[model samples]
Target: MSGPELRTERLVLRRWRDADRVPFAELNADPRVTEHFRSPLSRERSDALVDRIEAGFEEYGFGLWAVEVAGSGEFVGFTGLAVPSFEPPWGRSVEIGWRLAAHAWGHGYATEAATAALDHGFDVAGLPSVVSFTARTNVRSLAVMRRLGMTYDPADDFDHPVLPPGHRLRPHVVYRLTAADWRARRTG
Candidate 1:
């Protein structure tokens, strides 16, 4: 099932391409951009990530999209949904996430792209609910979660299994939004 292309006010969400590597690698290399999660990714890792995203597009039909500016056509970053690897408070739930180039920050692009992705997840994918999560100290992502109308689930917070036992980033906070919650937010 091929995913349909989606658009926001000033961006286009499409599948990854070979030519997207350089821009995507650059985005991954930015320390500020990857501060929330792990360290900066090497070019090789970034390329591999693009490949993984491509495969996800084919397998899941809705995965992290290659986000580009409509006018400049710049590959800013990606924003969409994926199944979280860690066992979560929501059980096995789809996750909504985003990562933009530093230059793309403060311009509402993350929110714009994510809003559209959420719409697609519910309307097209027919998902019942979606979850978004981040490090406990990642205030920026937390802010975006709140902006997306997600409610904090402190009881759901847990140590990320992928991280080492003593890792600072192991602890995570999760937020949830159901189809009913989304529809209410839409109408309100």
Candidate 2:
């Protein structure tokens, strides 16, 4: 499938451009934005990440597209689906995630962009299910998961492998939504 554009009421999910680098790097550098992450990536690292994200779109027909405000065209950040690389509480899983600039918080952008991504994942990509997870301490992200109609599975929550063994960030909660659940939510 060719890469497709996803539009929401206030955002546009599309391919990334070289022009998005600066804002994208800025978003990655913010402590608040990367609070649950390992660390703020340097500009060079951020550039490499963008390259990988773009490649995923090219190769897989979908990925974390660059998200921008519909009006001023400002780059907010990205939201979409990714294959979780490391082993965790849920084992191997398709994880949906989002990261937006600090200035873009509190406006439901994550929810908006994620809802679009989930739609594309299930309807367009034919995924059987999608899961989201984050460090249990990341209340904000957990709230976003709840807003997206995902439910927590305590049995699925596990220690994240990437962090130092036994670190606080290692404990994570898993939320899941299957295609049927998504369809029901969309129809209702």
Candidate 3:
């Protein structure tokens, strides 16, 4: 509870906990869950990722939040804001994203969690905008971005710098949503 906590109708987004590591690791190792990534992660790498996420929360007061179901308290996955390590046209900026287990998909959990995350970015963080990007082939995430009312600009497309050129996951598309736009969407 040292960090920010966000809630939606059916979800609670809060700080990482030790109990979340095993599920988080399983999520990272799932091929269906990591379809957009270069490859599945080893448990060591996954635990390291959890460490980084916790560090981000400690440093930024905001980071990829560990999401849970409201009543069941099941650790679904993560959804929230982070500063992308790689530089793109946007420079250093916060991005909203989500990653849930395959069992948690098709239930609008990602969208529900992401909606709250965007609200936090615009309202709590007072950020002008939040961005999200993924491989062009990632239709599910693209749909979630659209559901969050984020817009796509073809010109903003860029090959993921972390991915080698010509890599299958290199081609990526960018989506953006501004504070003003989020406000409008919330009201209108």
Candidate 4:
């Protein structure tokens, strides 16, 4: 099932398309873009990820949306809500996330696209709260989480379960925003 589309001042967050696969793979392969993860994704792995993302939409009714620049319609990346497959201490929760091409960075695209995703998660999906996390060293994503008014507590930090104990990216920091908090931020 294709997910609902969202629009921002500078972006269009919509479902993935066949045209998006190549660029998505390229983005996934960029070391600069995948630096927060274990390693850049191979083409096959990237395609597989897209398959899973599409399947997530089918099963959950919400999944990562393919993002594009509004006017030019250039595919930049993806941002949306997802259900974390692994168990965390916080229990079941939806996550708002984004990934963009290197050329899309520093333009606030992640922040813009993520805001729309958060709105849908809270306003449309009726999720009580949403969380975002990243490798501790990912200052860029951490900043976006802060901009979205997500609160962070060091106590919430955890070593990523999918990563080996000694891996540099295993250490992760989490940020959370409740529907109440999100609504407050919007109307206050």
Task: Supply candidate 3's per-residue lDDT for 164.
Answer: 96
Candidate-wise lDDT, in order: 0.89, 0.89, 0.92, 0.93
Off by over 4 Å in 4: none
Once fitted onto the true fold, the runs of candidate 2 whose alpha carbons sit more than 4 angstroms away are: 88-91
Tell me the spans in candidate 1 whose CA falls farther than 4 Å from its real position.
none
Between candidates 2 and 4, the one scoring higher on lDDT is 4
Q: Which residue pairs show backbone clashes in model 4?
A: none
> Candidate 3 clash total?
0
What TM-score quantifies how close candidate 4 is to the native fold? Answer: 0.97
Q: Give the TM-score of each candidate.
A: 0.95, 0.95, 0.97, 0.97
Task: Report residue 187 deviation for candidate 4 (angstroms).
Answer: 0.6
Task: Note the residue pairs that clash in candidate 1.
Answer: none
lDDT of 1: 0.89
- Candidate 1, residue 151: Cα displacement in angstroms equals 0.8
* Per-structure clash totals for the candidates: 0, 0, 0, 0
Q: Relative to the unseen true structure, what is the C-alpha lDDT of residue 87 in candidate 3, on a scale of 0 to 100?
A: 83
Write the residue-wise lDDT of candidate 4 on 120-185 in tens digits. Answer: 888888999999999999999999999999999999999999999899999999999999999999
